[model samples]
Target: MAPRKKKNASQIGSVSDNLPHNMGPVPEIIKSEIPAKALKEEPIDSPLPDSPVAKELVTPAKVTPETKKKAHKYKLNYEQSPFPDHPLPTPEVAEEVHRLLSKEHGQRKAPTKVPPPSATKSGCGEVPDLLDALLRTVLSANTSGVNSAAALQGLIQTFGAVNGSPNWHAVSQVKPEDITKAIHKGGLSVVKGKTIKNILSIIHAQNVERRDALLREKVTGEPAGVLATSHLTQIQKDAEIARIKENPLTMAWIFEIKKDSEIIDELLKLPGIGVKTASCCLLFNMQRPSFAVDTHVHRHCKWLGWVPLNATADQTFNHCDLRLPSHLKYGLHSLFIKHGKTCYKCRANTNPGSADWKKAKDCPIEHLVDRELTRKPRKRRRIEDSDESEGDSKVTSVKRKSSGSTVVKPTKKAAKITQSKPVKATPSRPLRASAVKARAQSSQVKDDSESEVEEVVSEYDE
Candidate 1:
């Protein structure tokens, strides 16, 4: 190719010079093809066009403040409990009902006053110690007062008392069977005895740990000359052991607990102490405003419509404690027990035909009783015997053989034989030609020999 000549910078036409200067405003068709707003970039603060494209491109709105939601109210203090709250009668109605029951049943002795805050002792009646109260309450469970008292007496006599209190340390040391023997009069002795023994063991273990901690603190505080052995002298050990025996085993630490719920929780951790038992201890022993629901209380509360018909004893207690006034708890519990026992109409298993029914022909709170909710005797199903049925000719009744010299045996069922399917035989491999020919030749030779022998015998006969 030939060498090209270079043009001067000014001589060459620019792109703008090459374009026709007469080009008018953009055609309407071309303007329609391109978006007017897209032709130029706008600041972010500017409002977007009211179109589908602009709608997608618009910035997300500032999140609006969340509206407040209503808080849910729990019926009982324990929100997680399975039982639901039942409609409670008015406090006035409850008070009036209590009055009527008190009048009819005769008021029980008022519960002992709560001990002063400074006082360390807290117990019910003659039972001066917390441990004694618990044991007495356990003995009284599911038994008559006389029987429970006798059982307690039996325990005292069998174990022998130290300083007028049952030697709990000695009881703890003995076998569970011995304790059962001691409290057999209580009924359910085996269970009660085991429970008592376990409670003692747990308390004894805790007490020992506490004593050791104290001893360690004492030993640390003492002068270096005073040996650890001196602090744990044989005499001191014997005296400590005697103290555990003579002193009614008391859980004084429990009294130190401030909250009633916490005290009940601690008591529940011990063996055989359920919500009812714990409540009993709280009300009668600790003199707290805790309402206990026993069989009598449970029955009366249901009849009075204080709790749902299907409510369990623990459920009854939870609802009643919350619903009933603090002052009424002690009186109501005492009145219910007394009325349930004495009132013929309300008492469990009351005989309608009995002469004693006259004593309580008219219940004190008959109008208050929820007749629908009151427990009724369950109707037993009448089982009709097949032999007793008439007009059944095909039916042969089976008679149970009487116990005698001849023994009746159960007949065995006949066994069924299952038919088996025949198995298909597999074909055998073909024999070799040489082996076959050899067998044939041997048979032919034998036949020829036999014929020759026959011929010779014929010749000899001729």
Candidate 2:
């Protein structure tokens, strides 16, 4: 077996044909191993690991000059809003509306002479204290202005300090029954009392936060030169902080917030404070520009077309604040309230046809009133006759003849004319049968024609 037999040429060719063709040289996977210490010695991309760092490294991956230049020149281009919810009034229209209202309301004249310091308008008109106005506004809800004022007076009288002013700290500490009894003059006493207490608690919490923040700075060994009570001793500072917590309405921070919108937002965080109440505080107490929308404001704005017909009272408030300038908010709100009370048509539950509305024919904004006075269509009432005699008399009376002749008798009038007097039976000429048949046929045709005409007319009316 020293020499092996040579393979056939055909077998070698078949094996070669089955082998893979067009194969490229495979690359070798060679991984270099380095020391662990070398990896630890490498520097990180960022210097401060805990600080807020940009995701992009200082040395960005290589980029083209054109890309880098374009990136530097990038800017945001914002498009104007396409859909606006509130209607924007022309300056002329606004001026006209204001003029008409001012003319009727006496132009909001200032005091002609200095009155005694004792005389003062309360609530939203002349109340300057933020917390005082807030409490008064809360009392005003769902009640008349007079009742609200009386309720506020009752509360202050019950809980007022020896100095004859409301002691809010004492009020906060009083029992719920005391709060309720004091504010019973205002409707919804139980609910309003809880809201008052809650508001006080929130304010107290804020005051505590402010106190802690100040004390924290002191503990940090921070310099006190910038602190509000830096000049006062530590004991005095504590007293001042205590006073701030007690009389939260007089807190410096409440009036320091510049934006009326921001102030309104803060007030909304308190219990019993709504948009109307907050806005009232902003406009009157804070003397800041804010639009307070109430039932009157809502109705008037809708009539003036500043707000849409479907807009709710809250929506009307936001819409007016956007469309009307800030300066006009206070005056317009006051005037609208006055006008709504005096205007016959503007009063609650009054419409154009009401007797009181007739007196409002000369309304100041008559020209600007775009809202239509729509009255419901009256239904057509059916009139029913209650007389029984009239209904019973409709039956027709029939008479039978003794003669061997069967004939339908005519009405009383016709019978009276044909046989007015009784006639002796002289075998007089019998009534012509043809005439009787003709008369019956003609009457039936007349009755059918009348009925057909009536049906046609009724159908046409429908």
lDDT (C-alpha, whole model) for all candidates: 0.62, 0.59
Candidate 1 residue-wise lDDT, 396-417, digit = tens = 2221212211112212211111
Task: Report the alpha-carbon TM-score of model 1 versus the true structure.
Answer: 0.56
Instruction: Write candidate 2's Cα lDDT for 1-462 as tens digits.
Output: 599889777545544345367342344557769644545577645434334453345643433344443321112111211115454554566667777888888675323332221111235534545666676677778887677766677777787642333577788887777888987977898998888888877777777766776677668867444234555576766665676766654545666566565666677778778778877776766666767888888777777777666666666666666667666676778888888788665554455543455756578787777545322333322111121212323322222223323333344454565587774544423434333443344344432132110101001000
Steric clashes per prediction: 0, 0
Give me the displacement of residue 422 in model 2, in angstroms.
56
Model 1 lowest lDDT segment of ten: 453-462
Error of 1 at 67 (Å): 29
lDDT score at residue 446, model 1, on the 0-100 scale? 30
**Which one wins on TM-score?**
2
- lDDT value, residue 234 of candidate 2: 67
Pairs of residues clashing in candidate 1: none
lDDT of 2 at 208: 74
